[model samples]
Target: MGWGGGRVLRDRNVVFYLSGVVVSGFGSSAMSLAAGVWTKSLTGSDSLAALTTFCVWAPILLGPVIGTLADRARRRPLLIWTNLGMAMVLLPLLAVHSSDQIWILFAVLTVYGISSVLLDAAEAALVATVVPETLRGDFNGLRMTANEGMKLVAPLLGALLFVQFGGTAVALLDAVTFVLAAMAFTLIRVSEPAPRPAKAQKWSAQVAEGIRCLRHQPALWRLVLAGAATMGVAGLNGASVYAVVDAGLHRPPAFAGVLYAVQGIGSVVIGLFSGALLRRMPERGFAAAGIMLFALGVALRVVPSAPVVLIASAMIGAGLPCVLIAAMTAVQRETPGDLLGRVAATANTLLFAPNAVALVAGAGLLALVGHDVLLLVAGAAAATAAIGCLLGSGTRAPAAAPALGGSVRVEDGGAEGSETAHDSR
Candidate 1:
């Protein structure tokens, strides 16, 4: 089709959605960097600094339930309201006078976290509705690239703002971005296809349906497990910040910020080449490689030196995007459009539940075995995931060619079974 003929960008709805996301992502990244640094500075406790990361990810563990609500309701309204609500929450941070008000910061972060769950689920469902199947991979890649690009600049900018002005100033900027994003969303008029009558049931029934839908998908389950393992490792890595400082490094604060920026750079690099790579390799293969690389990188943190750890951090960052891209692409390709929101949510929950566990565990573990042991655990988990992927190759399959207007069937072990297919627009 031509640019104006049934293409994704030609769909005014998608254009509006993408526009809003790009704007809001800029603010979100800024908030993340500012909050992390501010909280660390305020508490003078690495455990508390890690809480910022925990708060940001905590809601994702509840993503399936949030996604179900999105699927059952009008997604556009949810998207618009969530963004506005998030902006309002940032207002409280503007008034913080001292580090003692850390609870207030946590509260604001909690609100932001819930808003993120809603926004992400709505966006995923909306994209499936607006974009054509043929372009889903490219569209998703584009979205990922835009978000990473914003991240690349937001941290450095936020750091500068923090140094020059304060966290309050950075918070205000975040609020402004959310307001603009909400306004942009308001201008879009997209008619979400009504839920199928059969698909519309009691809330409990719908939730169960989502659960059942995923219960039998072996490949998806494996992917979820791998994602969770990675998150756990990431949690350990976050906890290692204090250890880095403890290892005789001066200005650990500054070094930590630089490490985060480096990771963002790695994400941007992977985003640039993801589309081509996806076409060249199977998703499972990419995931296995990423996991292996991540494992190796984390293992290097066993070294007690600052430079070695810094180099290891870069390697871990570089490997992460590959894993993320591979997993997300698999989900988009395998799930039926109608169940996309719920499935995405479920997958996200699996991905993040470990993060919560990891945070608490990492803190305790750090006190006991120190940073070296923590890194070793993370590396071992990644290695296990890699092995699992390698052994499960028989169950994993490439994305099928898009079928128009109906479900698709696959023969597993020569047994033909029909499964619902998500229509990509």
Candidate 2:
């Protein structure tokens, strides 16, 4: 009730930041979809084509380490340079001519992944400083909307570009977008203070601090844990996507795109309303409700009718982003700016890493247990996670963080995070 999306939309910095996210997100989505296709084209093996996705996600394992760099540097420069650097990194993909050179694409993808982690950390921290806290829900929701909106159209555009030109064109397209994103970052108007000097500590210690920050916050941990749970099951669903399309709905393999599009549409709708929903409920409740909806969606997947499958797919899309957006908002509000980058990164690694593991495991499980069993398992795991969150929501009393600068600190019995009260008001 206290936030206005239109007010946030009117801020100049919000406009530029969202612009950068949208542009880069399009490039990222397009590149990711095209990379697998590129690999399949270069080598006839579907296994290797799938490996490209793993290459992109593998850098998330190093999120803690790379995230520390975001804390150490000026976040704006970190963001701008990372985009420019990624632009340079994608150039090598232009030279790939043979399957032997496919390794080059993989290598580039890995670098791209690492840069993405750093970018995420910087963006989270930067948003805390630049955007008003009361409007952060709307701000974050809009950000999600921008990203999901890009995901909706970018791949189709990328595929079209790939077909009309080649992998080189898609690579160049992404590179050009990175350059444009860098330019967009240059346009944001923010007065970020210099980063504090790091105390004498081991690199591992720095990484551990971020992990501890998560552990120290009760609601934040539960939210992230919930996210990781649902994400893992989503991966299980993902591994069985083709199976669902073929065996479940009697649709062809390419029809998987329709289901995916349906999911994206749901995500877009939820993302647009996430801010208002967060206002009405605590972070845990918001996330738990989404997880429950996701559980229903995945559970309904056991029904094989085309109409039911489409509705379930839409529910899956609408439900998945709630926890992630909540976690991001909570971290930004709760963690000190000095520690935000690494903590944000650590949270991300936790929330997303399980999905990667489950993808492989679900694939193996599919060979034996089949898609229906995996879907049910995923649904149950998600429901169990939601119930845990709802039950645990009442137990924790998070300590009030000290005010930094001229900001005020307030804690409303841990229903949600309240970091800088001056901004919050």
Candidate 3:
């Protein structure tokens, strides 16, 4: 592979894929913000506002199946076709003219959700193939940074575009980005490692293979549990919009968006330094500390003050990515090349499955008891994650090397190899 554009170093595959991801990410972000605003404008119901999160996350529940397809087939086609399909799905959103058509918007969002599942599975599989095993952590961090960075701007731009040109224009813009992403994928060339089928394995056997892969790894499973629990608690924060607005705070709706931006800033800062952080802190330490911060934030929300709530929200958001990076690093480091997609998808499903439930439950609880009760629920869940991390012995430094030896390598100027080897036992 040669460098592109006389740049001292470049991997064409990474460049092409990164370009596609950045474009697609921006579009997705825009559509996401527009959809939320549209939903709120239509129903003026907090539960419906939370439904946007539900639709976004529901596809993750099918992550295992989507991941299996990615692992089983060629990933390039998956990426290209999914982006194109997503573009088509968004096309109808451009026709929305009235609040009564909110159901149409929901239907379109459901399609987007499905596309997201495929896109995420394909992207994870594709990155695993193109980036060598040694650099997976930094690469993952960089990927998050790019996605979140785009998120930071997408909402502001979407708000402006929606105001100036209407939601139809914003939807059209999202479709164009998808088309561009598909074109970018067309320029990338990398073959995924062939999936090794167990001889005479039945469908059940295949499912077992993926499950067993996760089950035998106690530490990885624990991390998965931790992620699911933490995400569930975070879901409450998302569903608390009504409470925030009812608190009599000036510009409460605006505060939600600003707090989200603050969280993005925190994530970008942590992600940029993730390589160094991962090297110094064990996965257990990172997981525990992150969840603790999140728990503290949720706990503080019980106070019901605007400043305190915003501060807590920011802390919770910042802590989440840190825990996620640590969990993802462990999975990427240990999983085999052929199974990486399935493992990643499986992990993703685990993380999001509870989140979906939490969103619905949080909405219902907010309606039934109140936002304060929801905060208590969120606080309890975060505390559970923190405790789980503390108690799970597998999260600690390995008593001895468990025989898995592989690494992910990214071509970017970021750290080139896995950080695990540098840790002093």
Candidate 4:
């Protein structure tokens, strides 16, 4: 498994798919960062600038519904056309010359958000069809590393482009990246199975299948719940970064970027090892360990020293991504191919909704409470989640054998693979 797992990275198709993801993700990150800046410049309103990001995020609320599009259509073609559509959407932004046309930018961002929902769902489904199961953990980890790395670099490039040539140039650059991504997607060659016969069900009923699939899998249910709980607290915890830099460590606000870079470095390193860790540990245990590490990282932030805070930031970065990768890999490994899109989308909504809410409420909550208190609260929440997973490990059921239509069922008292569940205990 290990030898084959490692070699999956060398597969041409996997490389092509990941390459497209990285290129498109980098461009998307740049455009997203510039949206706020462009809005602020055009209207000189901080509120409106903030609204630009919100506009991009708003379509995530429709993930389950939009994800149905992915499952109903062929995933690779869906991805190719989606990227093409987003490229055209960005083209209109090149013509934005005044505040009167600011709405056009917002509209494009909304399209970006909508595209993001479908892309995420489609990618998960497509990867399931193309990538070997043994390599899934590594693939997810590498994808995360790529995304985190982009966050560190893309904003700077976006700012530079916006300053030198204006928002139009940024849009043009983003459009070119999308075209490249489309070309990359087109390069991928996989013998996808014919589409499953359409179920004679209502739209609402189709959507319900996703939720039912998760609920029927006990292991997936526990993993998803743990992630949601962590995200709920992590949202509030994220607000403490600026506070820790500004007030706790007595540093300039810009210092937060340095800390973010440090965190991203940690995330990238841990992501490399995630596949190996998943091989040795149950996804639940890996997720639990990550949450515990994150809790410790949060607790360490109480120290006023800069070095301590930086170390804590790295720990937090490394810790949170473990949970995310574990949950995603579990979904990919366990889900049936035909239902993978909706299930992936539903899982995303479950995992990310709390983060969105927390981000929205983070500023107000920080104002209402002390930074130390918030950190402790976040740590406590995370610790509680980790402990819950630990205590439940011995009692929980194992993953069941794959069921009808190639769906793997995770019931109590069975193992996910040949590995023993007691390894977690």
Candidate 5:
């Protein structure tokens, strides 16, 4: 495809970018589901399977330091190399056979987690660089759709593949997707500056700046905090899915894929409408609504019916992405281009680190608490966060808020559109 000089066809960068996301997201989602199943099959421990997800998320703790790497390099090349590196890393997973080799799966997933850190930071920065400001909301919404849409299908495919073949088959498939995604990335072109001068700032200072940047932006800070709360509980909620299936619904482990697909359907629906929602509802309100929906969904899951579980999955699928996409779009709009990488990373660390902790804690706590109890706790927390966001937001509607990347600028006026968010990507 042509990479330059037209309106429709020339938007190849976005196309390539989304295409890569679709392919890689499918593989990643499949592998993520299969890893847990593989672990359960290898060892009868549910906690051990949840640990596989924990390994995949733990690397986000290093996001602040790792995110700076993106700003220090041309984003396009960084993205290309990172995708390729992830592909190479997944190759090691093919060695797993017996339960003893479970460590290999964890190790590979840990590496994948690190790769994800780079990808999120770079991709955020790159989008700011390549996409028109006006189009970000739609692009981000669509990206979420592609990602969650894969979650709907990939998990089933992975589970079936594992049932028929093995974890090695799933691993090989994931590795291939990584390669294909890298190739897709390489085909897109963008104009980027040389790396900022080394003397521009010390590395430690840069990392600190990223955190400080968010602190100074109240809207972004509040949004991110809400997201953190949501994810923190979401981790527990997610950790309960397998239990909900095995103990609550009395379904086999593979049935979890069916629920995931249901959730993906909800996500895709919300993603399609998200752009319009952003226009009517402020990012904060949109996120708050999502939080509430997710909480209610979790609460419904405690009903112990398969149909109710499916409904809960869709509620979760719809709700999680709203908070995520809203927070991400806010970060992109609020931070300066130079600090976008670090700021995005910092936000991710803040938002996702809690998820990692919750996952680990949930895994351990499952020994003591029932899945229904955990779901109740998660729902309460999310509902509380949602209410807090609404009550604290005061009377100002989100529609009155200024567009982040557009002509209307928001100043520190504490409301939207009053401040001009700097962007020199």
Candidate 6:
């Protein structure tokens, strides 16, 4: 299956959007790594160090509320300002020094996480508005590639910077990248229609609309339910990495990095091919396949062979992104532009909140169960979720599209005649 990379690249809007994503992803990845190292250096506590990640992800629980902000303005401007605002927000990190001041870093990262969620919603809305249906898959696949590509170098660079110049250097590096990303966003030439005035409703009511949209659609619900289960299991798998190295494979803790490296490679390969695969498969089918593949990989980890563990890591990585891509692509196609921001945010919350919670739950479970047992349970849970999707493939479609002010209309399976509102530059 040939990925339509050429068509995606030929579009300048996609190119600029990908460039911004790559630039920002590098900074974010680097900063994430360095933040942990920085906290450990100052506080000498692994719990506090891990808290950095929690700070970044915990705000996802508020996604439905925060997402409404995206629907209030044009998406391009929202993306630019969010990037620029976060850049300003990150600058405060440069001032942090003593362990007592570590709270500042957490504060900044929390805001960073909010912006990340906001940008995610806005970017999905913008992509749905501007990118062609035929090329959307390729563009999203490349987007995943660019983000994953950053992990290869950013973490090492951040670690080096932390060792050499301290955490402030990494903060500055990330701030610069945010500013650069803002610049890249400015270069995307597309016409955005003004946001429709959402009838005056209570803030909670507006948020509920996003939740309602996701639940009302049969396809979206099944895919999201499966995605939530898979990601939660993934968080469990993440918690098992060290234990697996020590007990399952009888390797040094450092061997964990080798597994991650192999996993990253698998992620990149699948991201490149996701566009082609989605073209031939329904989102639920694609997502279910991914879930099963991921479950098999986790189950195989119990084999205890070094080669087998590494191969399992690759399979896990390849399988993980499949559901994510399918879910977001489905959102882009199935959602009306008016509610895109809030709906995307709601879906993201449903998918990721479980993962965040599972991180804590997995850590606790590890204390009580063997890594092998934990993985087996995780694999079984994920597999069961996939089977539910497979058996429920004939679930009813969503109710007809809403008559909204924006140009987008809900279409079945991204039909060839999918009407998009775009002004070619």
> Which candidate achieves the best lDDT against the true structure?
2
Steric clash pairs (candidate 4): 397-412, 397-413, 398-412, 398-413, 398-414
Full-model lDDT for every candidate: 0.68, 0.81, 0.68, 0.77, 0.77, 0.80
Q: Give the per-residue lDDT of model 4 (tens digit) for 1-425.
A: 24223454555555666677677767888888788999999999999999998887788777788778778988878878988988888899978988999999998888888888888888888777655565567678877777787778988989999999999998998898888878877776655666788889998888888879988887787788889888877787777788988889999999998988988888888777787677667788888999999889988887899999999989989998888888888888788988988888888778878877887687788889888888898899999988776665331222321211222222232222110000000
In order of appearance, the predictions have TM-scores of 0.79, 0.92, 0.81, 0.91, 0.83, 0.92
Q: Report the Cα RMSD per candidate.
A: 7.4, 5.8, 6.4, 6.7, 7.1, 5.6
Candidate 1's displacement at residue 387, Å, is 1.8
Question: Model 3: per-residue lDDT, tens digit, 120-190?
Answer: 76666565555544344555666666677888998789979988888889889989998998898877654
lDDT of 6 by residue, 132-235 (tens): 65456666777777777788777888898889999999998888888888898787766678888878799899889988988898878888888998999998
Report how far off residue 352 is in candidate 5 (Å).
1.8
lDDT of 1 by residue, 224-253 (tens): 677778878787877777676566354456
lDDT of 4: 0.77
Model 4 spans > 4 angstroms off: 1-6, 392-425
In model 4, the worst 10-residue window by lDDT is 416-425
List the candidate 2 regions with Cα displacement exceeding 4 Å.
394-425
Off by over 4 Å in 5: 1-10, 36-50, 94-104, 163-165, 242-255, 304-306, 363-374, 391-425
lDDT (Cα, tens digit) per residue for candidate 5, span 92-208: 878888889899889988888888887888888777665555445566777777777777688779999999999999989988888888787777654466776766678899888
lDDT at position 411, candidate 3: 34
Compared with the true structure, model 5 gives a TM-score of 0.83
Model 3, position 276: C-alpha lDDT score: 48
Off by over 4 Å in 3: 1-12, 36-53, 94-105, 189-191, 196-205, 241-245, 248-251, 304-307, 367-373, 395-425
lDDT measured at residue 236 in model 4 versus the true structure, 0 to 100: 79
